[model samples]
Target chain A: MNKHKITGFQYFTVFFFLLNSFIPFLGFHKITMISNQDALFSIIIGSILMIGFTFLIKRLYFYLPNKTLFEKIKFLFPKGFFFILGILFLLSSCILLFVTQEFTSFIHFYLLPEVHQFLITLPFLLLIFYFLRKEQEVIFRTSEICFYFYILFFIISMFGILPQSNFLKIKPLFSTSISSILRSSLYFFLSFPLPLFLLLYFPKNSLKRKEGGQKTWIKSILFSGIFLFVTLFLILSSLGVQLTNLYKNPLMVTYQKISFLNILERVEATLSFSYVLLYFFPMVLLIYLLKELILYAFSLSPNYEDLVLLLLLIGNLLGNQFFSFHTNFYFSISIFLAVFLIFLSFYSFLKKE
Target chain B: MKKTKLLFIFTLLLLFTGCSSYTELNKLGIVSLLGIDYKDEEYHLYINVVEGEQDDGSLQKEYITYDATGESIDEALHFLYLKSNKKIYLSHMDVLVLSEDVINSKLQEIINYLLNHPEIRNNFELVELSSPMNILFEEKIDSKEISDLIQMNQEYMGTSFSVTFEHFLEDILIDKNSYLPLISFDKNLEINGISLLKNLKILDTLSTEETVLFNLLQNNINQAIYKNTTIVKNETNIEIKKNQITFHLKTEINKNSNKFKENLQKDLRKILIYYQDQDYDLLKLKYKMKQNHLSSLEDSNVLFPKTSLKFDIKISYTNSYLERRISK
Candidate 1:
């Protein structure tokens, strides 16, 4: 409970949680629903929905003031129901962990090919371990430290890409069909439910300054939503709609083109750094969820070593299958994630006893 | 207090480790543009190196030429890379200048090298020069201010086709067709406009007049010359504007032969009729007469420029036999 209660500024890294959903999907998902331009329109709708969903979650703390979405649902559901839902959520978090590791490795190959897998994996494992032992506030502050660099990079990338931003490629506007974009948006909304799942573990201190929490949460979500939309837009513009559809990883392809004046080249390194920051926090969040789920399932008495065992095993299992067949994993995981999200959404809203 | 030391050590370690991870400039030679030609039954790879400037402005270009015998373009490049001490960095390259000889003899090889090279970008300009490749950079050709003028003349005036590497690749790979700009350097090495490409290979290329006719088939011409539109006392120049190119098409099926005859004769007649019927030449002359008030050339304003656009018809036949000739 002491660890659960400690929330800090870095806790906002959960915003990046949603971004991971799409990033991994790009590398592995073979069933590209749309071309790059339409895919972008899909991503924009996703980012916007995510932004609104965060706002809705924040509004729940004040506007729907009686109980948290999960708590309200839990109170209504039978005891057995919560257990099944918890198990489902646990399974989803494990997959999230797998995807996070895979995407991080993808970045490693392009950005720092020289870096060994153990070295990159080691820091992340430590980050998860550090957050697992610390109180929520410490995790939040650590996330806050990481978040500042994340933001600094985000701002720098924005400015850096401006000159390269070919506006001509953005036109002819109102081109792609609206129905296609809405369907793509549903895919966007699928990844969004992760941060909403975190509301269950929020501390009492976080709830006290409800309005302040609302503002901070909303701003971060909006910023990240904009980040995702811009990322999609940049991918679409740099690699036209046709080629974007053909390529599996549009972001990597686009960033490979970040040459300014031929002197300051290779922004892929910068992008890789930024990408790790995005996945690292979400991954830690997933690890935290795993610890909580395991501790509850076995009644393992909140021991850190218990998690170390489970995670080391899980991370290795994930790391082993990381590059095996990305497309296959993506399809299986996306469908599973969709079903899990629908289950959670129904469970959260239905348990209002 | 302990965290401060921990943070310092981490930062110091990053700095130390970062040194080894960096991609060294000395080991990488920056390729600015590439040209591939065929000679002696081998692939000739030309890489234009910008060999970046030092702290001082004392920087000079270092051009590297790599040639090898290979079954494929990538094999040739790998061979070139193997022979060199430094890695060839190609992402910086902007212009891909193809020689006429290579474009004619081995276009497929040149295209494969450009399209497949991971270091090469799609947005780079694809220029074809008639003058030998070495003469392209003879003078420091930097007319940065008049970029629009240079592009229009190069791309539109049909001295060459303005094709980006990406567009060229995209058209050739996907659409199965592409056109590129043609270049010809004068005695002073001044590069001129483009020529068209029919597939991955050059088509029957267009001269200035044929280029006009070929380009007219596709509408979107901002300027054109109406050659011999007017035969006046001083022989005035005709600058064109507000032009439209509409085809008067008639497709007649010749049942006897079971073939389709496209009578482009209607379109030709329409064009000739329009030229002969319009007396805009006389109207322009009247207007100029009024503006000048018949005051000779001395009193004209610098800004007010005018030219008479007219038509002249000469009916003569070279192929007609005297025995078969009729009075006109």
Candidate 2:
């Protein structure tokens, strides 16, 4: 096995954690608002759509097993087009800075109310900078280590939150119009599997064993989809549709209700910290992707990689100070990236390069 | 050179640690209970702060009541901060008391404030008081005693139910009405019954007996003693038909099952009729209808009063230790 390549399980952990982190912050409230009690159905349909999309991407991966999506785009598209693609990747990476700002705002509002936003953002960005300086395999290995704790905390939290869940609140399902449910499902698709386009940046050769990697990817999607479905179900049932729509972070609010045998209470802050940990994985990955794009786009030597990363972190910190991105902004950008990925995959397949 | 760089990095890490936001424990006036009242176009705030350590090593936990008034809750809280020597910490608060005037006029503001406040958790119990400051002043009741009283009454007598902030908000949002356990002071703090609220105002108050039936209908009772009978279990099921809603209450009692069943059915019907006359969805019948997808009627509020309500009660006698032996 190649030392630099990651194991299929590590890849699974990376995608699983990435898929799970995005929903509670971005997709959950919007979907619940649109479909109401039928949000669970939206997740079900959305997962199937996501699985189908993953299969198509898997086929595309098999067609060009040795090259990353960027290399393949460069191989097929014109030189100018590849530069445009590089710029798009750069823009996408920059858009992810809003997530850093959001993370800061969430911590400032919920955990450390008295702490300055810069205090939170500075250390957070520094941590990301340190992680980005490491090899890509290190990030995957870190995700593997964190995935166990994520699952353990999730199971422990469920033990406390499940008893409070009232299934009656999920009643009258399918009462929402089909169009509404479909629209919500589209939002889920945009929020979840669409972002998995980032994973395609790694070539098939980047995995230790590419044969089983597709199965791992599909399994991870299924697992993360089930986790999100259960979470949305619990939020709706425990909070009801009206309350679910009322709060910005309904899942965190639901976390406040967790009490294990009435002995352990107020573990929301701890659970939310775990959520912040999950957010770190994607941030590091985005910065790494940005570095790669900057190097490839400018045809720069490898020595400037660290300098490019430093510039990206500073740029993100400055960008966060000026702009505030909401769910619509994320949805629009995600849709754009998903469409771009789909277009690239089909063009590569049709060109047979 | 590398060691120097590492030392500098560690120093930067020390700077990032939450020293800026840190406050010593002795500097915090831990608020255990908060009360709000509206009078003279101002908000009256009362907070019970837990302070003072014991002579022994163990904490003594003495309670101090602080009162302040302002045009808004935040301003009143600011005034409260000025009076208290330590920083007012509200995360540890166990209960919040709202006066009748505050509930009548400033309930929306109160809800918004609680919902938006970073320190205030929705897990704290919310209670209604006629004169919250007067009761806090005269009774000297802390949050623990008040929460315990409500919990005990809810579990045993079923004449009162504990309503947390989350539960209250969910009820209002889902059912368009909610209820709070009404607390009063007469020589000592006592739970009177419950105050019904709708459209951000107190509609009416339920008596102790009526509250028992209310808890029964809502399936909130764990174990209640009613009319010398120990109600071990209660399961309420609602069936909605075309123009009538039916309640099937299955109950288990330790003794006097037959007589208690008759009184319970009659009392439950009477309470339902009284609330129906006022067009109040006391039992959340409309919410249940909507949940069951049977809310076809355009104006459930207008037709609910005229709609027929039927009660089907099933009672089972649970044998005591001696009775079980005798039967065997």
Candidate 3:
């Protein structure tokens, strides 16, 4: 077995990489679905729910050290049930593939309307392939380096859009029904890092201490909590609810609102290019996790991981052609996977006790 | 090592090779101001551009206007692009001018086209002209100059506030209505007043005097000097025969401050009464009422002319002039 030990800093950096991957498109739209007034409230509730899931995943890690969730599933389930576990893992990977497809389609239509979808996704798949070839530490290092660029661009774009926010646009609190707010929270839970347990394959030896994983989890929640809340607030205040829905990518629209002296225009193109910086490592990491999970599921040799990587790359390239993003389909798949993982974790703990 | 270098070079090349249909700057016809007019059952688009050239080692700017007619504003813009020297770029467009006819009838169509166009910016100021197409080729005054004139006119003169396309969209979305500053060009261009819009149709056009009162009623007086000769506080009344009254000016009477407040209230009420018959609430008081959750003005209810709305002007005056007089 290969050792994939990473220090606390690298772990936290990769955690942020995971957290921000959901942000570029999914998280922004989900909050707006709740309504403009309730977007802020939904974000707080969503953060708490995600944090609780992270803590649960951390507790699971403690229950079975140095083991992936799939390995725990095999131990908890009866003999020959590993095949069922493998199918579940494959379905989870498909969800991640669906996300990459959505991201690819967004870039294809919104960013490069003239470019073909295949051409737009090619570079992303290639980058992921390269990362898959490298050691897991390489991804952690890349994420650490990319984190600086993310924060810098975040600050720059926030400053540019600071003055454009009209707080009056956010309607009074509780304007939306409780059911709608809860539904938005559920959509948020399914879309964001709550479902990121698919990639919770960190080796126990990688942690410097027993509690290192939980610390990273808390730090990521704190950092990403502030980041998401501020971003949602800025979007709601700047575009309002109706106009926010009017644009497919409200972040780019928010970037377009930035007028430096009102002459240096089209800053959205330059600023939003930085989103590639934020998303590239996370994209590669998702693909890498998928590769590892597939190899482990089929009980293949580590050398055959490259073959899985190629297959997944080809899968992503053709994924959007075959499948389209439906909110109901995505929400159902996410809820099923989330419940399955939770049940597996609970069963494992009871069996051990 | 050789393979690594080759891969690195290939990746670097891919990064620089952006996927865009590249067009040279010279091949692009940059639209500085866009004018839309509806006449004869057709939409007309006027592209106002400042075509500058480096002739004899000096920069020379020439104003050129292009006109295209179509069934709709979008089609008309495409037609205008087809007849242009280069591909029309609307990113640099700072001003949008609509004919009164176009605004009165086709405002929604124009707004939808502008919003849907990823190229057209939201910060561009919108103004309605009586002759929108003629202003395109009006000579000497380029688009940038006209935009600056309107912006300055709003900032200092205080007749009407400049409404950006973004703010106009926001106002429409929030209040279900909005207002745009109106400009008229006879010999020279001047801001005539503001046009009140109720869901893209022009409800009414307020004249310059009415716009001034509108600005005062809204309390958006950035720095406009309003001159009126009357003072009616609680105890005293002084009526001066002056036409220009600046609100920021210090009235030198602690005792007569109430009287001044009364006079200002009386004048504001008089202006409100004058506009009451029009059924247009320029102050957006109903919106305020909705915000406070007052059930009198329901969210679905449109304020009528006979709603009997009252204006309680809270005059906050830090009277240093009166304080100094008392010290003396």
Standalone chain B TM-score for every prediction: 0.52, 0.90, 0.76
Off by over 4 Å in 2: A1-4, A55-60, B1-7, B54-58, B222-235, B250-264, B296-303, B314-328
Q: Considering lDDT, which of the candidate structures 1 and 3 is the better prediction for this target?
A: 3
List pairs with backbone clashes in candidate 3: B226-B245, B227-B244, B227-B245, B232-B259, B233-B258, B233-B259
Predicted complex 1: CAPRI docking category: incorrect
Candidate 3, residues B12-87, lDDT tens digits: the string is 5486344446677767777888888888999988877766655565657675788889997777877887787788
Candidate number 1, chain A TM-score: 0.75
Best by lDDT: 2
What is the descending TM-score order?
A: 2, 3, 1
Q: Cα deviation of A19 in candidate 3 (Å)? A: 2.6
The candidates, ranked best first by lDDT, are 2, 3, 1
Q: All models, DockQ values?
A: 0.06, 0.67, 0.25
Give the Å shift of residue B262 in candidate 2: 5.0
Q: Write down the lDDT that model 2 would get.
A: 0.81
- Candidate with more favorable, higher TM-score: 2 or 3: 2
The 10-residue segment with the lowest total lDDT in model 2 chain B: B294-303
- TM-score (all chains, Cα) for each model: 0.62, 0.92, 0.84
Give the per-residue lDDT digits (tens) of candidate 1, residues A215-274: 556665566666776766765566555455555566666666676677876676766576
lDDT of candidate 2 over B1-328, digit per residue (tens): 7578557656776799678789999778999888999999999999988887655757777887888999999999999998998899999889999989999999988999999999888889999986546667545588999999999999988989999998899888876589999988767888889999988799999988788888888888888878777889999887887589888889888885557877888898898898898878887777676677766324566667778989899998888899889979
